[model samples]
Target: MPLYKEIILKDNAKLYLWKITEDIEYLKHAVKLNTNSQNRVDSMKSESHQKGFLAARMLLQHIGYTDFDLYYDTFGKPHLTDGKHISISHSHTFSAIAISNQSIGLDIEQVKEKILKIASRFMDVSHLENLSETEKRIKATVIWGIKESIFKIKNIEGISFRNHIFEEDFSLEDKKATATLKYENKEENFDILFDSAEDYIFVCAFEKQ
Candidate 1:
């Protein structure tokens, strides 16, 4: 699959998704990676991980950028050389990236029943009340992505999903929500956008200005 979807969340922010249908060999030859990225891919033990890594770069090329224009900071957050904010995520068969003029975070996760088992560990389980088993799983997955995306935006140390990140109550049909981060005596808010693709949930977070 080429580009699974392209979403213009805002005038300055966009999201790109790639469904990983091609083999590693096809992805390897589809995009040219820098030496560092090539070495990183070579060091990956899981073919799924390698394909996800490569698919991300493939998306960059589809958007007129490449691996060479991307770099990471000491905290392992990705940034573009041209000063655009970038976040990357991959789960199972899907890879995605969000680029924006403002700080942003992106995350994709496969919906699974296991999330319900540990939902209390990272989110407010009360939010799960009155839902069918399937809805609970999807909502839990989205809340998890909400916290993950916010963490990516902050990239700070000692932020616990259970304690520090909080998602406001929202229904599945809303497809968007807000979250708060209370860590180290600092309180910050973020705008959240999320949707499902197949069995996967992808979320985007933007630091509220």
Candidate 2:
């Protein structure tokens, strides 16, 4: 229930993951939130969402930072007071945050069959071929995470997952891949690293230098 995992990425980015097993009350008591975060959590209609938000703060504290040191820009992208890049994501019962000296993005998604049903909308369907139903579900979820992570890094408007983001062909065994964001007449490359935690898939994206 504490920090579930810590990953030191190849790019030197540090990622922290937390499994949300604590009740909302316990999480509320564990971390101090700024007034804005408190109001944001109070406005959440779902207890699960609130727990996820708190779990993220719990991770911040685990790494020697607190809510007061974190803030969101006009686009809602999170940044640290010390100028480190930060990205936060929570899904189902998992919460995760990634920190890097360079720009970065992080996303986590629960593996579900539903992702396969809509895979074509955001990814190249051909990449889904030659895989079992279960693999398809996991791969689709990863691709979705890929696009979501990249979008977080760019934090720009008018980017479409189905149109601007693209993932190259990759097999599950690879455990990593690459993607490109072609938006506004410019193409940016990103290095992607992904893995499964419990039933969730988490992806991290770092812009290529």
Candidate 3:
């Protein structure tokens, strides 16, 4: 499970996913990491986290990038040295990245019943109307991913998922959506694309042009 999938969302934007099926030792030797990345990996307490980090590097390499070409800002947002927009996300067993000429955000989350318990916190419960229990979970997870993606793009403080981001009504059949980010007298719109695979939902948010 090296590169799970590569999606050309637009002419200038692409997405990559890496399935973390290799052991840490295998990954350690499979990819090359910069000193900073090596130290960061060494500081990780959980093997899962280390593997996720390594898998992200592997995905970057698949796109002709290495850890040396990536860095994080003060807000912990990742950027490429070549002035490309990059965003990264990792859940339990998968890591993903999106690179674009313009700003973009990417997020992946496992579909779990637990999101239903916190549905009220992040999304409009009414949006979940007329759907089965399974649909509810999927919708909730997508909405959560939507907000997370937007947050990554903005990476601003005081941005509460429940309070700042808003998603419009959408259906699973559409496989697409839109969201608004309203914070601190600033308003922005995003084009959203999403799909589910193997019980995981990944969402991509691109700044409206």
Candidate 4:
């Protein structure tokens, strides 16, 4: 699958989204890697992961980094070797990569109705009550995307969706939302850019300061 879009943000940040297709073998070949022994029996899973990683690395290279080595922090958040803030998220066959000088968080998820089942875990009463019935499910997915981005930026695990991840109202009219990080006693705000297209939705958050 090729990249669907490349967004250039205000501060030299780049957001790349790659479409996923059903050709698992082709994707594996694109990465020039053989499936791992454990994943050999599951070609689909292996290919999806490989393709996402390869596409992300290519984006990193375009920004002047030749080597792409990903290691997780203590919280299991993936980090780049040189300390740049990078976040990756993949759902189904689609993958997204976001990199910036400022700390960043990004997430990509296939738009699906299943999100409705878990909406309460991530959204507050106010957020939930505001959505129209038709829009509520879609909004749930968007909230999930924001939460994922928040998690990657904080590089911390154990935060619950209901308690920690909070958001200001997002609108399709404006394509923007605000998320807050409440840790200890301080609050930090981040801007969220949302793109919803053809069965998929992506969200990215960045520290404005």
Question: Ten-residue segment with the worst summed lDDT in candidate 2?
Answer: 6-15
Screening candidate 4 with a backbone cut-off below 3 angstroms (N, C-alpha, C), the clashing residue pairs are none
- Candidates sorted by lDDT, best first: 1, 2, 3, 4
TM-score of candidate 2 on Cα atoms, chains taken together:
0.98
Cα lDDT of model 2 overall? Answer: 0.94
lDDT of 4 at 89: 82
Q: Which ten residues in a row have the lowest lDDT in candidate 4?
A: 32-41
Sorted by TM-score (best first), the order is 1, 2, 3, 4
Return whichever of 2 and 3 wins on lDDT. Answer: 2
Q: In candidate 1, what residue range of length 10 has the lowest lDDT sum?
A: 70-79
Query: For model 1, how does the per-residue alpha-carbon lDDT over 1-209 read when each residue is reduced to its tens digit?
Result: 99999999899999999999999999999989999899999999999999999999999999999999999898988999999999999999999999999999999999998999999999999999999999999999999999999999999988999999999999999999999999999899999999988999999999999
Q: Can you write out model 4's per-residue Cα lDDT over 1-209, one digit (the tens) per residue?
A: 45677888556678877776636455435443224412432544555676566655455445555333555556666677777777888776677778777788898888777778777667864665766776776777788888888777876556776787689876766778888878767687888888875778888888768
The clash count of every prediction, one per candidate, is 0, 0, 0, 0
CA error at residue 76 for candidate 3, angstroms: 0.9
Q: Against the hidden reference, what TM-scores do the models get?
A: 0.98, 0.98, 0.98, 0.80
- What do the candidate models score in CA lDDT, each in turn? 0.95, 0.94, 0.93, 0.70
All candidates: CA RMSD in angstroms? 0.7, 0.8, 0.9, 3.6
| Range of the 10 consecutive residues with the lowest summed lDDT in candidate 3 | 1-10
For model 2, how does the per-residue alpha-carbon lDDT over 81-139 read when each residue is reduced to its tens digit? Answer: 99999999999899999999999999999999889779889999999899999999999
lDDT of 1: 0.95
